[model samples]
Target: MKVTEAAAQLGVSPRRVRALIADGRIRAHRVGVGWEIDGLAPSKERRALSVRSWLMLGRAVRSRALVGLSGHDRMRTAERIRRLRESDRPSRLLADWRPADAPAELYLDSLTARADRADDDYIRAALQRGPEYLRSRFDLAEVVASERAIRGESREELAERASVSARLVKNIESSQPLTSPGEVRRVLRALDIEPTALPDMVLS
Candidate 1:
């Protein structure tokens, strides 16, 4: 698809598509004097899509635009709330989504104003706490190590799989910090493991 079309499909502006192409994250080719995005970096695309969706939801809520929200808007808002409540939410995406053309302070100010009027204190507090609570719950290193060990993966092979140095993997097995639940979740996702599978280690 052409750059503009691809960006539109991704729900991002055309400039973002060009930037990704320029950064070599997305492959493109010139076709009839226009740039066409022929392929995408799946991981990057997923990340971008996720961030974009979160930002969109934040933007809508901050704008106080939900008072009259309907169908898609309501669904989008609910999704954002769910994701924000998720552990290791990459909460930074909220701040990162503010448009450059618009001051971030403005967006935040708007969010604060809207939040103040919200009827649900639980939702507001969750938003205020952000994703830090989730990060503190799980250790990425230990999760990765556990997954590798359980899979009968060789230490060297596991290190490569986890994209970490052998030394790091070795240390993680003994003293890894589960500082971020999100990291643990990603490791589990990679290995199709789950926290419930290790009931003995659940935080008290």
Candidate 2:
């Protein structure tokens, strides 16, 4: 189908359709003065073109937020308003622009997690821990505490990453006592510490 026809059938603008084609997300080829798209392809082609404008608006918002351009960056935040006039989406997001402008660092951290297809808490925690935060200790529990301290991450956050209770993390860090094999593995894995390198036993 022609780009314009595909855009119309998908209930979006030709501009968005062209953008998708350019990004190689949509299967298409340019010929002569126009482009052709395989609207019926099974490559998620017909999955859902529903988010065209919404994604446009979202990209705009994220771009503006990245540039620290609060309430500005109309293409990302405002241009679509004229097309979809008086919609609640823009109004709602606009209301909380301040928070989105600065955006918590965890938000992007979570995004990186999602990008890696990492669904487990331990993996998320490890990514958040980062390589620079790795510790140099050989003791089991002390290594755990050192790992957490090096990252400057709270017990609560580490607990979430390990998918364990915060109380358990605290106890491990404080008492330095031995626990079940599984619990030790979970905590160490969350901290990105090699389980075999530091067993549950105390190191001399």
Candidate 3:
């Protein structure tokens, strides 16, 4: 099938199909000026890639290499590693991967638990002040705090990176309303976190 036909079948744009081919997420061969894809082969290849991506993600997380990476870069690295793992025939398994494959959920849960612990600690501290001291608008506070902690960044260090004042970073983590919303966006960017990932209150 042609690129357009494959794109239609995959429910992705033609450009995305070309990118997948380039990334080895989809298998295709050049036929003169165009590419030829076997029917349903793309789907099978994508499924294989997904599994490989998860395996690579697990390895990266274990190594702590995923800590400071932007979400986009982390996934991209996983995909790249998957391709290398597939191509390298010297060893079937990458170093640190157990002799037996473990469920992807284990790694996912470990990462989630680490972040959750940070968020929970922040929330508990807030609750100690008073139930009424907590503001719904500051819901993003936990998110920022958790992500920053996961990245091993101090408030002062994050403020310096974001080009904001350390006091402002402290206030944001404390769930206080900021006089300048732009500072919040800056902090999020400094953490390599997308603002859209948080609650809508962040934007407001």
Candidate 4:
């Protein structure tokens, strides 16, 4: 089968097929000019990691330990990290896929260790905060921005749906308090979120 045919069968782009071949995850043979895929391999069910996990992986790639990775793997990892940083909502595949190499395994382990320490610090901080302080730190900006990105809606589109000005949506997302509670509720309702459920942290 040709690369295009194999890609179709695998439900991935031609570029992704090539990447899989390079990673030795796919079997292919060189033909006259292009390569011919033997057959489709059994697909692995990989879950996407959290945004925090992706950030940790990016950090690991930037560390001095990156020199331990193969030149090819290092270049690919750096390119992917650049794309991930530039994208507003990076693809889930970026978090799911990684090189199956010893160096990559070590990097993953390092990310896990960093995450464990961060989680512990977060728990400790939360324990020290009073109920009122915790309520006030609901992080409305983060929630609104994340939800908007997940829905793939621009500020203009969200504002239109919420029947508010785009500037108002931007202000809310930038952590600027909205004076009108009704407007805030409308925005939350447009996002299919329960306004009453969230604490009145950033909204007036």
The clash count of every prediction, one per candidate, is 3, 1, 0, 0
Q: Report the lDDT tens digits of candidate 2 across residue range 1-204.
A: 898776655444677668678877778877887887866344242232233433433443233211222233423334342222222122222222222233344443343334345233432232232323222222444556544644547899999988899987877766545556676678877766654443344433
**What is the full ranking by TM-score, best candidate first?**
4, 3, 2, 1
Q: Tell me the TM-score of model 3.
A: 0.34
Q: Model 3: runs farther than 4 Å from truth?
A: 1-136, 197-204
Candidate 2 lDDT (Cα, 0 to 1) = 0.49
Span of 10 residues, lowest total lDDT, candidate 4: 126-135
Clashes of 1: 3
Prediction 2 TM-score vs. true: 0.30
Question: 101-143, model 4: which lDDT tens digit per residue?
Answer: 3244554554444444434333222212121111221355555
Q: Rate the local accuracy (lDDT) of all candidates.
A: 0.47, 0.49, 0.54, 0.54
Residue 73 error for model 4, in Å?
Answer: 19
Worst 10 residues of 1 by lDDT: 129-138
Model 1 over residues 1-204: C-alpha lDDT tens digits? Answer: 787677645544566567678888789998887797887555232343343454556554443223334456555554444333331322333333434444345555555344445423433453431221223222434444433533446667765665555664564455544333443444445455444432113342
Single out the weakest 10-residue window by summed lDDT for candidate 2.
83-92
Q: Is candidate 1 or candidate 4 better by lDDT?
A: 4
